[model samples]
Structure formats: C-alpha cells, structure tokens
Target: MTTTTISEVKSINTPSVIQINADIPLDQALEELIRNSKEISITRGKRKGKFETGADKEGLELLPESSKERLQADGIDIQAGYPEAPPREDIPIYLDQAFEIRNYDVPFVDRGKNADPEKKSLFGAATEIINLTKNVGTEIVGLQLEDLTDQQKDELALLIAERVVVFFRDQKLSPSAQHKLGDYYGNVEVHAQVAHVPGLPGTTVIWNDYQVKKGMNLNFATSNLSNWDSTKYLNVGNQGWHTDLVHERQPAGYTHLHLDAIPDVGGDTIWSSGYGAYDKLSDEFKKFLDGKEAVYVSAHQYLDREDPFGGPKRIERVHPLVRTHPATGWKFLYVNRGMTKRIVGLSPVESDLVLNYLFDVYEKNADIQVRFKWTNSKQGYGTSAIWDNRISQHRNVWDHEGDQPRHGTRVTSLAEKPYFDPESKSQREALGKYLHQWD
Candidate 1:
C-alpha cells in the first residue's frame, strides 16, 4: 500500500486545502487525517476553522463530531456520511475531469456581519477580470472553467456573487464542463419544466427555433414581440428582463448560459443589476418594500400546450421583493417583470402600480446594466454569460432575423429561497466602489 506523508503534502501547492482520496486503507487514512489536522492547527493564522473568528470563512471546517455517527467501515476502509451510488443514477456531467467535491466551508463571518472581515481587494482572485460595467457585468478571461482549482472556484463564486454577471469569450465549454462549473458553486439544478440536452442531465437547451420544447413555448411563439402575433399566443413573457426558474421558491443561484451559436448581428443580451435597482429607490420606497412579498408565476407554464419536458407541476411562489445575498449580505430588488404576478398584502390595483414601478426601475436604468454583443473570434473560440440570478436580470435580444439562429445551453445552480434581512447592506456599500453611481 502506498502511504502519503507530510513531505508529499508540502510538495504540492495546497497550503490550506486537504485532498482526501476515496477508498484508501484505514491505516493510511487515519495517518493523513491526523497529520493534516495537526498541520492545520499549526497553520491557523492564514486559514482558520469555520468556528473560529477569522478574516474569511474560506478555510475548511473540521469534521463535526456528530458526523462520526454516520461513519461506515468495511473491514479495510472508512467512509463518512457516504451513500451508495445506484447504477442507473449514474451519468458523468463532467467527463475526463476527476475530483470528489468537498463539502463547503463555513463562510468566514456569515457575510462579515458578526465577525471581523479579512482585508479583501477588488479582484480577490488571481484570475484576469475586466469589468464590463460600473456595477453589473464583468468579462473574465485567462481562465477556463475546467482548469479551476477548488480555491479559485470559491473565489470565482465570490466574484460573480458581487459582480452580478461575469462573461467569458472563446470558452468552448462543453455541457459537462458547464454543469460541473455550476456544481462547483452550488447544486447543479435540473429545470423541472424545460427541455435539456439529450445525455447532459442538467444542461438546458435554449433552442430559439422550431425544435424548442413545450415549456417556454409561448415566449418563443410570441417571438419576443410587443404586439400579439397572428396566433394570439398570450403575447407576453421573457422579452423583458427575467431570472430563470424564479417561479419556484428556492430560485436558481448561478446560471451559466453558453451561447455556442451566435449570430453575427442583433443577438446581443443585456444584464441589469438588481443591487442598482434597489439602491436607486427612495428611502421611503425602500422602507415600504422591506417586508413586502410578491407572488411570481410563469406564463409559459400555464400555456395551452402539452407539457413537453415532463416534471412536477410548476408552482407559483411568494418571495420577498427585496432579497439579501447570502454570500455577501448585500441587498437587491428581487422582483422581475417576466414572472412576478402580484404583490401580496396589497389591493390588485395597488399591486399593479407597485409592480409596474419596480419594472420601470429595472427597464429605465441603463447605468447599472451592461449589454454584450455575442460573437466568436476568427478562430473557433466562443462566449458564455454567467450570472448570479438572485441579484440580476437578463434579456436576450433577438434582432437577428436571418436563417442563422441563436442557440445555447444554460445550467442553473440551486440556492436558498429568496429572503430579505433588514441588516443587509446595498450592493454599492458592499463593494466599496462605484458609490452612488446608480443613484
């Protein structure tokens, strides 16, 4: 049996992360665990445990004593809180990539609300990030999704959480890599109501043409136009800004939409920052919206077509109009024009007025948004737009009216339900740059 030692650990670049190989001999496992735990204790200054008061909760947390109850041993090896993988339930989202996804570390300070924050600069990661807008969008280059180390992935999550949307050019990311990238940040979410790539389980196919499926059909049938079409297919949805899968309570966290097939002209997409919308609201308006909730319903789901992608019935959910970002503790206006049905606790007319005003805030504001004209280089490189749906809204521009069509796959990650915390700061306050730019 091969044994890993401290010298071997030091030889690798992982100063803080612990790499645990699966199915190792019990003796070797214990030795490495104990040795690594000791090494962690000595190196506590740079990286602190989850329970400890530290700069950032980016450090690994100790395995809980309670987890010991769930440990299983099979004569030669020990597995902690492990479940048997069913044969039929197996499909590799990321092919050729290998690594067990480690459990998420406890954040440094629960968004720095209760603990002292470690000093962090604008671009916290070592990746190349070019800001596309003052508040909303950023283009991240010099890195591929497949090549990200665990720590770098964590940092990228933090960056996108703050920036709202990060764009990539020429990233020929496969559906597997796209899904895996979403998994690194959170759970790869399968669309309950939309069609997906044939073999790729969670990767959604946003085919903007004839082959598109049942869900989101009304939007396609309407051709993203303002007026009613000849067929009169309900005539409203998705031409405006929207967050994907917001019809559910626990909305999608991160969305990696890869536009592999881009039209040469008129297929540009726009992203607006929810943080900017919230911050620009009047103090009285903000206070009025603080505890209020809104009900969101998907128009396409209720369309009079047979359900194409079969799943559970999509249910309308009530969520806070103003939501707090769990990672950064920043506040954003969460209401979107696409799916938002009504504001609860208000009269129908009052709800209409309020919702219309909120929609106006997102639509009229160009200061907090970035528009990207999608394209590929002369060589075969492509662009993908990744966004934090919780604090952002995106609209796909379909001005391209030729035989060439727009097509892409989108992967959405699951996150906690939309919520509002009175203590949460605005996006402007959290970043410490672009102050009052939106207002």
Candidate 2:
C-alpha cells in the first residue's frame, strides 16, 4: 500500500495527478483518486507513471512506421485530421461538375438529314414528307401502315429509336392487321390483367360504355348519369400518369391504341413526354433528386382499399427519381401519379413537396405534350398510335355521352426494365425517332 497526494495537478496537455488521503494499494488509490478528481485529463500516464511528452507519444512514433509501409490506404488523413489543413474558406461547389441540368427543349428536324438520301427515301413517301419536331417528341402523318414497305419499316424503326413515341392517323387496319404491323416492331404481348374482347386474344379493349354497364349490373336505367365520375368510372381506364403495367416484375414496353370507333364529341387522348419533364427541372431540384429512389406500387390503384382481395395488396418497387431510356439514351422523369408512392430517401414532407412540384411541371409544359382528338371521320377510324412506355405517358378523355358506343383494341409489346444513365443527355436524334416530321 502507498499514499500519494496530487500536490498541484497540472493539465499541461497530459494527465494530471489526483491526491488520495489514505495509504492504499496503487490500483485502489489510483481508482479512488480518479473517482474524486474534478475532471479526468484526456491523456493517461505512461506505465512508468510519467506523463507522455509530445516526443514520446505513441501516435507520433507510429507516423514514420505507417509512412514506410509500401501500400498506402486512401481516405481521410486521420493523422492530419483534414488533408494538409482545414479548409481555409467554405469550399465552393463547382456547379458544372457537381450538378448537370439537361435541356428538354427537343428540336424538330428531318430525321434523315444524317442518313443517306437513298436510304432516307426508302421509308417511302410518308417518311419523306413527314418531319419530326426538334423538341422532345414528334407527330407523324401520311404514311399508313397498309402501304408501308420494308424500307419504310426500317425507317420507322430508326425514327422510333430517335423519337420515343409515334402517332399515325387514318390507319384503316383491323385488329389483326394492327397486330401484324406491331409484329414488325417487337414481340406483341397481351395485357395479362385487363378486359379483352372475347376470342380476340391480342387486343385489350378500352370500354367506357361496357365497363359502366357492367358496374351497374347491365341495367341501363341504373347506370345512366348526367355527370361523369372521373375517379369512380372507366371513362378512360388507366387515366393516371404511368408507364403501362409497371406493377409486374416485367412491364409492357410498346402500347398501341387504335381508335376503332370515335364518338361525335369528346374522347381524346393526351400524351406527355417524360424526357421533357425531366429536362425542365431546376438544377437545385435535380441535385436533391439525383441518386434518390421512390416506391412504385400498382396495387395502390388496382387493389381494393378496405378489404384487399389479393392478400394485403402491395407491389412496391424502387425506381430512381430520374432515369435514362435504355433504347433512346435520354433522361426522363421516372415517377408517375399512378404508381409512385413515397420517395426512398426523403421525409414525408420533402417527398410530397418535390413530387408535387414535378407533377405540376409535367402538367404545365404544353410544348412537350400532344393531344389526339378523335373525330368520327373515316380517317379517324383508322388511327392507331404506338408510344414508348419507358418515356411517355398517355391519358384518355371521356367526354362523349351518347347512345353510340365507343370501343378500341390495344396491343402491348413486352419490354425490358427501366434504368437510369447519368452520362448521356437528351439528343435530337433520340427525339426524332418518335416525333415524325408531320406534327
């Protein structure tokens, strides 16, 4: 047992001594001194009971040994705390390198300007006369599928690669003919879970009248209503902004809708370019959004809320805030009202603010949108439209109310999953592929 007194405790960048009253074992006395001390110094005394000087510190001694090792680890410089010295001034973020804001304004031009003249002409008269909007989309006319030759097919494929969506008017092709035409583009797959015309396996019918009647149990008197219930009814089924059938592990790629029967009034479809929506966002918003993900679940729209028919009915999937079209290599706004739920990295308030702002942007940009109004003309009867699901959104307007029933068949194409690419930006070639010259 030994007795010691702290005498005059000094900090001196080292452990200070504390005095003990009684003669005691070194360990016990040290523990009692530590317990009684007003504050404990960060540095502990050396085994020999002497405070460690800067020259004898273990950390200082190990620095040379660490430097002598051939393999050097890369990370924060722990020895220096910060590299070289602490930042003198708050580091300035280089906007160009730290963030990139893409231009969404797509230019309209002759898609064949870069191709050989002979090869360009090979798409037939339609390809020759039709021009594409230089901007993010295109509207095509003149070349009917019935008259499309092999050269035209090739040209159309090229156009599709450039423009994300293509619209044709006065098609005059039957469901079988339309399916045949779609076959040239890709493998046409039937929508696994939608109303289809009996016996017509390839076609999915967008039936407002039929759906309404069915809802009312086929009783006409009970189903008649003066006003339209946009939410409750299927005036335009799948009206929300969404890529088609993204709920499935595998989603449909190409969507073709032919206006077989047009009402005398109302019943038009509107499309918005996802690429344009992405391009219009502010740099601050884009940076905050970059690398963040969101949940997309189909069951939210398809499943019953009160008593979910298929178990709890949740089909959540994570998708990036911005995604690049795999085929076109263009960035697009990846979220949709129909499927997107909460953003992955954001708090509830933050997610709502950002998503609502994006939704407003998509709604306000008229230049990046196209509205297809269906007329009862013979040419309108033949109108068939095909668009890329990965980068486009479509909505059908249900304003027609008459005894005359309207119906059409849709053929969907199977496509690969959506992904994002940070390197490539939206280009004219990509825009030209879908928006034909004839807008």
Candidate 3:
C-alpha cells in the first residue's frame, strides 16, 4: 500500500507483447505497430522484402500482443471469426446485383377489348351467331360456308370453343367446300384408313353401306360390329370417352362430319360430354381415379388375323384415368370404347368391374347426352357437325339403314394435346346447369 510499482500501470508499449512480422515498408510497418500495439521482434532494412519476424525464422509469426488482448477480451468472438473460413475463390462479381422483377400472376388480357369501335363493330356483326352461343350451344342460321367473311370465320372459332359442338343444317357445301370450312379451324388431315371419293385427292369418305358400288374410290368397313371382340376394324368405332385415336402418340384434335343422305327415321348421332361425365361421378370414384393410369389396346371385331387392318396389332398407351382439357383446363374421364384396356395397380377382375361401371355411368346419363335427329331443313344441303374431340364423344345409330343411304366425308385436325386446369370449376358449374337441358 505504501509503494505502488509502475508495472501495475498499463503500458502504451508493453514488454509482455509478442513480436509481429509484416512484409511491408518500414513506414507502413511502423504504422501497424502503433495501431495494433504489436512489438517488432525483428525489423527490415527499412526496404521491401527485407523484414522477417522471429517466428518466421522457423515457421509463421507469433500472435501479436494486441491480438492476444482482443482474444482475451472476446474469447468466443475471436474463436467464431477465425473458425476455418477460407477466402472466397472464384466468386461471381454480380452475385448480389439487383435484377428486374416481373409479376407472373397477372393473366394476359385480350387486346381486342380496346380495339377501334368501328372495326370491332364490323367484326361483331358478322360474328353475332358465334357470340350468342358463348355460354351455351346454339343453332347457326342464315350463314353459308362459301359466303362467310373473315369476321364470320373468327366468330366460328369462338363459337366452337364455347359450344364444344356446332350443327349446320341443310348446308349446300360439297365435300371439298366442307373440307375448306374445316380448314378455317386448323389444318385438315384425311383419316388414316377410310373410304375416299374416287379421284377425289384429300377426301376421305364415311359411307357405312356396302351396297353402293358406284364411283367406288375407297370402301372400308370397321370390324367393330362384325367381330365383337375384334378391335381392328372397330379401331375407329365406338371410341368411347376419347377425343380421337389418342392411342396414337399424336391424336387428332378436331373432327368434322357431314350427314349427307341421312335415313328418314333413325340413325341419330349421340354425343356425350366427357367433362360432364367426370362431374357426375361420386366423390369416391373421383378420388379413386385421381392418380390411376390405364393401358389402351386396339383389336378387331371381325378379322381373325393378328394384322386385321394391316396396322400395328395393338396400340398401347398410359394415360391418366382423369385427364384435363388443355384449353378449358377442366378434368375429364379418359376411358373410351376403342382402346382402353387395363388399369394400373389393379387386378384384371377389379379393372373390368371399374371400367364397366364407368361405361355404364357414361351410357346412362342422358342429361350429359345430346342426340341430334337429322331432318330436312331449309338451312342448306348436307347436315354437317364439327366438334372438338378433346372433350366430347360421339356415336351413330345403325337404325337408319333401310330409309336413306347415309354417308359423308370427314376432315380431321392435329391440334394441341388436351390438358386440364384446376381453375375451370366455373365451366363445370355451367355445364352442370345445362345438364337438364341435354336430357
């Protein structure tokens, strides 16, 4: 108490400090010494590359006193900072740069909405029939295929998308003209294997009668009815719940059929909405088919040989039991009569039971069905029907055999694959509302 040692006072330059070696200029080294309070055990010749610390004599320089002091003050912090963090190598210079942000949530709005009024009104007038059926199906009147304007063509496209199917009564269009009208929808491809009018290049005929031998260009009959189990000839028959030839890797997207010389009393064509078919199923059935897939094969009804139609014996594919429509984004049952074979992860017996039940449901629901009776109308000449194969099914009645010879030509389009949308609940609701009307 009587005497206090000067050593007790903190030294501005303490002897307890460890020596530091720095490969720097004398002036710069001196600055570091003052800044870190590090003692220089060895100094340079006051020039570059001449300095070396005592620790460097053997290996690396010892810790400076200032560093030790910092460590003692914050032991954890020092340890954390020095823990094996290597210098960043090959880092991208723009890693932290800002970018132009974009909003993807907003849907693209139709620019035609704000187009010039005069131009819009002109197109509107011609597309009136198409506009009227935007929410439901309608019969087109006072419009001929040959007389359609560009506006009318645009209107027809919109109508087909909304109504799913459109009927032209008593059309005076020849096979070629009808084919041209279908071209407006998209490119038309002749059916792979069907009767074609003689010398009519690009025309595929749909005549079912074997009696007519005049101007015989192409005469082909499906074996579906002839050989019940044979699916080859029936390859194109009763393609239930399917668009068209989905068994192919690329299926036809659109099909147009003209009812020329229809029987007087019978042979009406029936169409069922596959989208509606899915809506009518019980929740349990829907859930069961949600993730399941099936295999579809084509066979013949009449031919006994393996190569019934000189095509591949079986066309097998794996498609979801519930497929979504591409444009409308709505889900639908994908099973059909022509090709669907077996369900994945189910026994043969179980698959058959499930498929049969689904078939029964589609067959029984009259509300989801529309039967068009062809009657003589002043509208035009041939009774033509155009439908999107992506979401609808059609069948012909054999009852009109003896009345009037029924035959026509069809043009198919290879359009985009069908897809489903989760947001198409509104479309389903609208379809449900019209269920009773179909019945």
Candidate 4:
C-alpha cells in the first residue's frame, strides 16, 4: 500500500493541509498505537484491538451516542475517541473547482416587462404600494415573500431596481426560505469570513450582541471598524454609508435583511438612492463621470506574509464610478463613502476632491433617502428590507441605547461587475422630468 506524507499533500496544495500541523500529536499517538497493537479475532474479521481507534478517550466520550454505537458495531474502540485513518489507497484525491474563488456570473433577465402598473396589474396577489420617499424606498403591503410565483419574483426584482429599497412588515421568512429567495435573484454570496446561521450557507447572522452573548466576535469584511484607530470617533463622519460587497469581483446586487428581533425604539436603517444622487449632479458633471472608474477597498485587512514589516493589506477592486442598472437601463452613481478610495486617471488631490463631493451628494441629501423603522406597530417584531445594492447605499443606525437586542439575518446575492453604458439615461432623463442640479 502506498503511503502519502504530509509534505506530499502540502506540495499539491491540498486544502486539508491546514489541519496537519495541529494534528501532529494525534499522528504520533496513532503511530504508537500501531507499534503496540495486538491482533484479535472479531465477529467481522481479525483486527488490532483498540489500535483502530486513532482518537483519545476524552474525544470518544464527547462523541454522540449514535456515533459511539456505529463505531462499536464497526468493531472500532468507541471508548478510545479518534477513528482509524483509512488506507492511503482508499482515499482518492481529485482536483475540485469549488475550492477556487471565481467571479459569480449572475443570470440577468430583465423582469421590468412583467411590472405593468395598469389597473389590474401589480406584483401578483393583492397589494398596496407605500412610497416611503418620492424616489427611493417603497413598501409592498400585501404578499408574503415565501409564497411568490416566478412571475411575481421577476416583477419584485423590477420594483426593487426602480425603488432602490423595499420594506415588508409582519412576514414569516425562515433562513432556508431566505436562501431560496436569494438564489432566485442571483448567486447567493456565502462568505466564509462572516458569521452565518448554523447549517445555512448564505444567511449571515447580524446580531449586534452576538459577541457578548456567544463569547465570539462577528467580523464582516464590509464593516469599517478595522480601518479606524483611537481617532475613530472624530474620523467616522459619513463613512458608514456604503453599498454592500463593493470589493468583490462581481459586486452585490440584491441584499435582503430580515430583522427578527428589534428594540422597542431606535435601530432604524437608512437607505440613500444612487439614482437620485446621480440626478443631483450637473449635466456636465454627469458627462465627465460617465465612463470614469474608482477604486474600492475591503474593510478587513489581511496579513501580508511576504512583506518585511508584516503589515496588513486590504483587498481592493476597481469599478466604474457610474454604473447602469440592467433592469432599468438607467445610469446611477456607484461610489460609496465607506469603501471607495480614489478615482482612476486622476491626481490624488483631484480624486479626493471629486470623491468627497460625490460622497456628500449621496449621504447629505435627505430628500433622496428613506429611513425605515424595523419595529412594526402591529407585528411589534419582524420586519424585512430588500434593497438593490447596485443603486443604493445603506447604514444601520445604532441609536437604540442600553442592552436592547437588535438582531437580523441577511442574504446577499452577487451580481454582474459594475459597468457603465453611455447609451443609458438617468431616471429623470428617461422620464423626461426636470431635475434641479447643484450650483
């Protein structure tokens, strides 16, 4: 029988090599057991007594009763913990493409055709549209997300692209159901870096008190906490407003956040419209920024092992400054105050001036924004907000003081990379409406 060493596995870049260094002691114990093993005749066949169990006694005790029974039936020592390593010949190693990180290709089908705003037409079933703002957010008052027809889901996608952010109250959407809904939109982003629901791949647990309750830290790559120092309080102005997953090769499209637990008051979320922000700029300014690109950096820093100083480096991506929504064929500003660092092909000072102005247009403007309260008056509990990440920036307000819990589950679907279409018109331009621009 051929025996493969740990070095051999490491040479091939086997993903399980991460465990080898830590499991050296177990390997040593297995070697000792094998050296001292005594052959015994069992019901199945002749085998080494207790030598087959590679685990320690404590490890075996920690295993489930069902697992122990199965091990006992297999003639393995249940009391002694670790299971014997199968022969190297039995373990086949094949290259898996799933281990490689690649750009997500979203199946983009424009569903705006199904969104007929006629007398009998709405997004399937009975519904009342509550416009939170003149431009950005809307609330679809009737249907449950769990029970949506394919046609209805298409229309809903269209509505979210148009409205930017949509809110639903008193809805029962489980983690599994949420994942399915996200998949319908696009490829649900399952981030290995974030804290997610147990057994649920794409559902990120957004519990504010998770660290305190679970004695574990929940660090999302989109969070800006790692970028700041002791001067954080003074430096954190308007930096919280950001589009989700901007550093990704294929950025976020639709982000659905379902808040199950919310305080009696406060912890409201505010979403700003990219469409409105773009319209706020002058025609000349829009023309200038139409094909420009910007650099976006991820919030978390990774150690640069190759560097002599061993300093941390953030993941960076370059995307168009102005991006067109595929569903609407409308151009919108894509830079965020949080992750967006600089504009390409411009000097440092020029880039800073331009980016700061663009940030202000989105964050400072109140008319193009929607602030939604999670605690419904009737439901008094669950509320959901599904926003189009392509044309919006959102911030979670932590105004709720004391130990009041604010918890939620979020599922984000990755869409196509940011692209600017010169043929795409602004919302106002497409609608033939006049927009007052900044002087």
lDDT (tens digit, per residue) of candidate 3 on 131-235: 222333445655566676666555554444445677767666665566676665554554322334333323455544421221112223432242233233332
- TM-score ranking of the models: 4, 1, 2, 3
TM-scores, all candidates, are 0.65, 0.60, 0.57, 0.71
TM-score-wise, the better of 1 and 3 is 1
Best candidate (score: TM-score): 4
* Global Cα RMSD, each model: 20.0, 26.9, 32.5, 12.7
- TM-score result, candidate 1: 0.65
Looking at model 3, residue 265 earns an lDDT score of 88
Residue ranges of candidate 3 with Cα displaced over 4 Å: 1-137, 199-202, 211-243, 298-312, 378-380, 421-426, 430-439
Model 3 scores what on Cα lDDT? 0.49
- Pairs in clash, predicted candidate 4: 55-82
Q: What is the C-alpha lDDT of each candidate?
A: 0.59, 0.51, 0.49, 0.66
TM-score of 2: 0.60
Better of 1 and 4 by lDDT: 4
lDDT of 4 by residue, 289-390 (tens): 999999987644443323413543556779999999988889999987668889999999999889888888988899999999886555433678999998
Candidate 1, 193: how far from true, in Å? 3.8
